[model samples]
Target: MTDTTNTDEQDPAQAEEGAIMRFMRATELDTRLLGMVAALLLIWVGFHFFGYFKNGFAAFLTPRNLWNLSVQTSSIGIMATGMVLVIVTRHIDLSVGSVLGFSAIVMGVLQVNILPEYLGLGHPLIWIIAVIAGILVGALVGSLHGFLIAYGGIPAFIVTLGGLLVWRGMAFLIARGETISPVDSTFALLGGGPYGAIGAVGSWIVGLGACAIIIFLAWRGRANRRLHGFKLRPMWAEYFMTGLACAVAIGATLLVNSYPWPKGIVRRYAAANDITVPEGGLFISHGFAIPVLILLAVGVLMTILMTRTRFGRYVFAIGGNPEAAKLAGINTEWMTVKIFALMGGLAGLSAVVASARLGSATNALGTLDELYVIAAAVIGGTSLSGGIGTIYGAILGALVMQSLQTGMVLIGFDAAMQQVVVGTVLVLAVYLDNKYRGATK
Candidate 1:
């Protein structure tokens, strides 16, 4: 009671802060991420209602379509992560589509023709060997391009543009312009299908594990902040974040579990297992595809690489100011080569998923993929001017781009119209990015 009535002036900044701004600050949420999420939700809802009104069925929001959309997004999403680094460093790789096709062709030839001859058909080692070989081929191609740009003084644009044509031509030559089919059964599973999915129980396990990890990470982060004498988020904020992440994990698990295997597949599965079908039809969840898992793994690894490594710091430093970075003792030239090599390796991995998904390899497998990859990165908020990007952003961008195409397809838009719409969106994304940057400045 001695000085209870005494008052202190409120801080000017706090006094001016609005409720939305205060909430954002407390949660430490990324505005860009929130914007993208809102946009995606809008797209999903719009497409779902449109489909319902037009066709008397809500096709877009169905489990079947969403599951298929995730699979389709896998290839482009895989490549889009690497594209973030490339664009963040103020460079471009026009050859990723070509590289994917070329590497996929190499993997196909090895599994279908060469390895089978040496290791015999259905050899356990064939898939592993082919995968490794494809990744190496991609890395080698990327390194060569990086070398030309960093050492030979050729511009990245020129180098990758030349590579685009060269690699496609090389893919055609490798297969003699023919498709390779009936890949190793084990390898085909990597592409994803009923056989390639993890099922309901596995999905639940993964979801719970993810939730656990999220909570642990959040706790550790707070501990580290305290240890380093940095400010800590309020307990409520910490709980909010952890809960949000866990909810997302659980929700995704529910979504994937809700989509049952097709009736034909169920019948075949039951016959193979010697089980009688129930009257209502057997229910088998296609919980999550192997390819989707692969994409998630890549995203986690890339996020770690970018956020918790010296190599990552170097990449951002170079992107922020190449000349200054070099002057500060960073080996910018070699770093460029390494970055490109990583991009190439990812492209190779994407090739594996793409060709495996198709159950065959064709010289035309990755046609125009470059356009999608770049657009995804850009739409996710990677700055072409350099030094700003996030791995998750690119993944979300890839999903958005794929969602647009899928929604259009569901509504019966032809290939030409799809391309036009995608193109317009890309331009709009760029314009928004520029405006956002300007306003922030």
Candidate 2:
């Protein structure tokens, strides 16, 4: 009656202004991050096309390679998210690697040695309790670091440096210079090898679920922005980007799902174990590793905590100007403690994933990983000086780092070169951040 169709068509462009503006703002803020993403994709393509063999697909781009690459990145990816929060608050956690080793040892000891003798628990329940114990041990270590830095007023670097030694020593005491292995099949799945994989079907389900959630959130965010009178991108742009994202998501799922397991290998494997073979020639695919899912979950939580909550606001405020935040009545010290605690928690999760993946626990479980985690965070565009970072970017940074490592392996390059390249990348990232900040000032 009131030309409603015409009105709708006419106002649709304006209606999406809020979403468009927000997207643009984020893009502008994350220009470097976008560039890093592009760089990662380029590496993926380049390594396959240019490096080593003239194989059908680039070596690194193969389904098995990609699947393994993702799993390799998972542990550090989890830590990188938490490192984002710590770096955002202008703090650092130098002991995460050691804590990971110590906590992992705690988990392993509980599952293999302690439980059999004392609790006599079996299967899923023991696995569950062991993981919780690992996490708790990690939190305790984090709380101690937090207290020392926040309450005792010791410098964060110094306090965490001390923790680096103490935790590693504890791990040594736990393991006594021996590798502990033969973990339960269920417990081993957490580490993400074939035994730990969710398989192809499970991977598809997870990927689809993740994609759906992302799209729903994007739509809801746009609607909220429009309601709040914020500017947004045009509807066309939103749809285009969203479509692109969905395409990538589905493509990734297919790639992982299509990696063919050798028929002979499956047959022999079944035969050796006297297991029944299905009619469809094994009907199996290694979909996604559970650790990847865990990393995704941690990444999402970190992203939300850093972007959507009061704690996030305070973190930025304190990082930007501690004195000003304190003047504004924020509990800066306690917040610092909490941030470190979160970092410790993620490190604990990393231990769980790493220990599970290896099917063993050793004192050297997390050796040098603190450096890896820090470098990933910095390369992802988390500022060392603080007040800036993103969990997604940090996770991507971990991916990029692992990509380089995996590519080198595929190409048969010296593994030691990884440290050289990572060091260079890290130095370059710090230099760029400093330059950008200076230019801005």
Candidate 3:
């Protein structure tokens, strides 16, 4: 009986050791994951409080309002994805907003006039052409910036800053200072319409597919690492994280789609002798935006490129130690150029989406876009000195910026105050990031 009791005590201790080991392994597997999640939760809580104090609890997490917030976030979020790559490589592209604006204007022109008249395109087909054109234009602009930066010895910041002005000027020239009104219905659909509804559905499908692919890849990667005798997180912990990620994705989708139709309505009585009339209210889904899907796709692709590719590794090397990377036979210059080109292309895509949503292209379309993009990247944890960053982090940063903008607007903050607040946040984020890095070092 004494021997049996001793064995029982040993078993419990063993179990506790095992549990502790598992927790430690998980903590090591993804150190930043918890912090990132915590940051997001904190942002939500802050927003919730702001809404509650200003407009009561119901204003917080209204389904329609949530959907609007997502849509508003999409545009900047998409650009930030590309900005992540540029920042990871210790570079910046200040011209992205201008590039976006230019691309959008071009797409609008094509959709409204060129496609219908020259290409004989239908509604959806016109949208396809516009998207294609936007991407191509973006790529070309990026390549130009890359060429100047990589080969001409021009700083990326300078080149892109010049590009910001050049492109804005070009936009004015293209649209002649007029707000290219009466955008094609087809093009409008690309911004956020019924196609946007289709886009939301598409987002779910893609998210699921991405989750599956990630799980498979992660499992295979773990197996390979183990086989090669590399350090790896335990299998169960990895699976748990993967499951949790998938659940979050699914939950987000459901939450965004939960609002009732005809979200708000109003009634009017003409006069004492006149009859009353009821009119259907404005629905949030009515403005459901497709830009969100585009941003998601861009984010996913950027994450894959950053985390899974050799090019991504080279980017880190270049950022961390350019001289060392060059000595090690990495094509540093070419890579820089390529990165810039890629950024330009992304800018173009963003511009197109924004333009479509606005249904017009104007000289002011991309003004100060570079500042926002740069701020987003820096806030997302991309080191200004280069080397360490993640695409997902940039996306999060962009979302935070977007949320701040949205919340401020909802709370009736003016443009000047918004700018002041954003600038302050950017400074604070940079200070915190630098402090964290210094402590870690």
Q: Best candidate, lDDT-wise? A: 1
Q: Which stretches of candidate 2 lie over 4 Å from their true place?
A: 1-29, 53-58, 262-265, 268-283, 433-441
Between the candidate structures 2 and 3, which one is better when assessed by lDDT? 2
Better of 1 and 2 by lDDT: 1
TM-score of each prediction: 0.97, 0.88, 0.84
List candidate 3 stretches off by more than 4 Å: 1-24, 27-29, 121-124, 199-211, 261-289
Q: For residues 1-441, write the lDDT of model 2, one tens digit per residue.
A: 665455453477655679655565443335666678788988888788866455444577778889889899999999999888888888899999999999998888888888767656565678888888888888888988988899999988999999999999999997897787766567888887664677777878888987898699779979998999987767766776677778888887887777656677678778989988888887567677788888878887877888899998898888888899999999988897788888888888899999988888888999999989988998888888878888888998899888888887776668688778767877876787678768757
Worst 10 residues of 2 by lDDT: 20-29
**Cα RMSD (angstroms) for every candidate in the order listed:** 4.2, 6.2, 7.5
Output the lDDT of residue 214, model 1. 99
TM-score between candidate 1 and the true structure = 0.97
* TM-score-better candidate, 1 vs 3: 1
lDDT of 1 by residue, 287-317 (tens): 9898999999999999999989988888888
Best by TM-score: 1
Residue 17 of candidate 2: its Cα lDDT? 75
